[model samples]
Target: MSLRHTLLAAVAAVAMTGLAASAQAKTEITWWHAMGGELGKKVEEIAANFNKSQDQYELKAIYKGNYTETMTAAIAAFRAGQQPDIVQVFEVGTATMMAAKGAVYPVYKLMNDSGLKWDPNAFLPAVVGYYTDTDGNMLSMPFNSSTPVLYYNKDAFEKAGLDPNSPPKTWQELAADSKKIIDSGAATCGFTTGWQSWVQIENFSAWHNIPIGTKSNGFGGLDTQLTINSPLDVRHIGDMAAWQKDGIFKYGGRRSDSAPLFYSGECAMYMNSSGSYAGVKGNAKFAFGVGMLPYYDDVKGAPQNSIIGGATLWVLQGHDKAEYKGVAAFFNYLSSPEVQADWHQFSGYLPITQAAYELTKKQGFYEKNPGTDVAVKQITLNKPTENSKGLRFGNFVQIRDIINEELENIWAGKKSAKQGLDDAVKRGNELLRQFEADNS
Candidate 1:
């Protein structure tokens, strides 16, 4: 062979090797989340789908325990310089994540920096508002957003001689029907709730168009003070406390511990995150129904939109540029209408994007399911007032624990409703102040 032919052959071989290496180079993005059980499987399925759709990126999703544990782990990992590329922090952790200036990559900025197409207005306002900074830029990508709803056993309602189709709409009616259910021995308890602080106070205030704190529930500034000890709050909490004494309202353990009470038929009514739809549907032996949360009939502008409860996906700092690109691609894939709709329907979480919600409706999913739209309607019925948008208090996880302690006192009859709530406000405000000081 001639020398020129040998040199040409060697150059061709080198070029072929470079092509193979480029084909094999793929970015791996790590996502740490809180979903467990069936939901965790769904999260894995989503990651699998994203992985299969492209050869340039692979998503590795890890379940890091519950919401609090997941957030704590991410923060600890961040401090240790081993944080995951993405973390799912519950809605209560929004303020904390936002305050950690150097710890997070704001979702809006991340998408834009990666040149991904993102529309902040395409998402449901109430769902996105919780994670948005005061400047209106979204800090996290909403993943599994939900609102509280009323769940009832249809058979239990019928046995109590009440109309199964007509669930209670007002608190007064709820009280009357709850008494009927108990007196007729249809269930061991009339009603029980999970996340007492979430359902009974935070959401309760938003649903009634009452401010939970002085500065738009802390969305305005970190200096906000708790105003949850007002007359309406006192009246509602006191009434629930009174009902506890009369055996009408049962105090189940906090944070979805009471879900079994309804599913096992021990409680006639249950109030919890709409995400509980999956658990109740899977476990209930009898027919069940979902309804909008009950509210006071006489309060002006009452029955306003309820706040969201689920978590969002936060992109953490210190990841590679390639990983951020992969993260942006994954987020954009998740935001697609088909993917978002499937996640919403399968997981019983509210569809976070307007397109997803409309796509679900256009597909006739709501018509086929009947009451599955209750959460959607309840959250979007009115433009969110300052009170209805959502809460963003600092150190909110601890504040919720403090409020739960005070509420437990009310349930145990150790303190009156007014006193317990007042004490919660006082203690919670101190933590807020401390958080402000620490973060400021």
Candidate 2:
């Protein structure tokens, strides 16, 4: 061959190789999440796995802080035009996210725009309901969804002469058992709970089949009003206040501050998110058991499905098409049965997909771990009522703080339960009005 032809052929081969390398380069998608510790590691693992499985995309998982902190950071970043591609927002923040119309790119829209096959029906009804809009469009991808459950130290139950296997199923039974545990010196206190507004008031109202607020707990409209100061709410809170006074129920600080109380063997019984299973299993020294959240047996339609407590991954707006395509791909990867099931087992969170749940059952995970199914069963036991589906109050973060302040007052004996809750409702309504005015 001629020397000129040979040189030209070699240069063309090198140019083609360079173009292929550039084409194969990955589009990086940033995900800011609230998960920490073991959960955080799982997030990293999921990202790493997705990165390994594909050449077109890379997911970078960043732990911003706790749920509130992570959300705040995302909002700040959005305002600064430096937001991540995705941010995990807790269920309570659903209304706020919905109100920020321009700031978020709905998951349904993102998937559709990216040419990904999306089915809202593939997810558990209750899990998806919380993050969906009134039109039934999914706003975010459900991740690490969980419900509150009763966790008790079996050793404490045995020492207290209660049946370690049969955990309390009703409010009265819980109180009775808690008193016995305290009296018998089985533990320092009877019971404590985390996320007081979530577990105690929100789920508490739903579990009793009562309205947390008018307008289907704000699902109907932004002009919702709080009904949580109703007779039922007052009665339940008063009962808890009485227990606190009797030293039968200890009032641990908000969120998961009470988690240590249970695992440390200081508190015999605790109520928190089912997702805490991994934390308890890894940290608790004593034998422990999980049970359905207790309810007041006297209430009509009691023991309803508990509401979900975890966060969902929301794709933010203003990202490039390539980055969004990467987000869509990563979300699809995360939602697969294999990834979802593993995450469900590893993190003690509910599987977001029906296929994942069924896969876990087929694998005999529930059979091997007796109480691990409590949260799943509790969350899916019955068809969700408007009350049980979940809450959507506006300005929930501030409203939650208001409720917590009143609850602290009740715990401190400075106010009666009725008075505290009534005040919370009144004060919370003003905030709701403000949110409505600000967003409307």
Highest lDDT, which number?
Answer: 1
Q: Give per-residue CA lDDT, model 1, range 128-233, as digits (tens).
A: 8888888889999999999999999999999999999999999999999989998899987889998988999999999999999988899999999999899999
Report, for all candidates in order, the number of backbone clashes.
0, 0
Taking all chains together, the TM-score of candidate 1 against the true structure is 0.95
Best by TM-score: 1
Q: Name the weakest run of 10 consecutive residues (lDDT summed) in model 1.
A: 243-252
Error of 1 at 83 (Å): 1.5
lDDT of 1 at 138: 90
Q: How much lDDT does each candidate structure score?
A: 0.92, 0.91
- Give the TM-score (vs. native) of candidate 2: 0.93
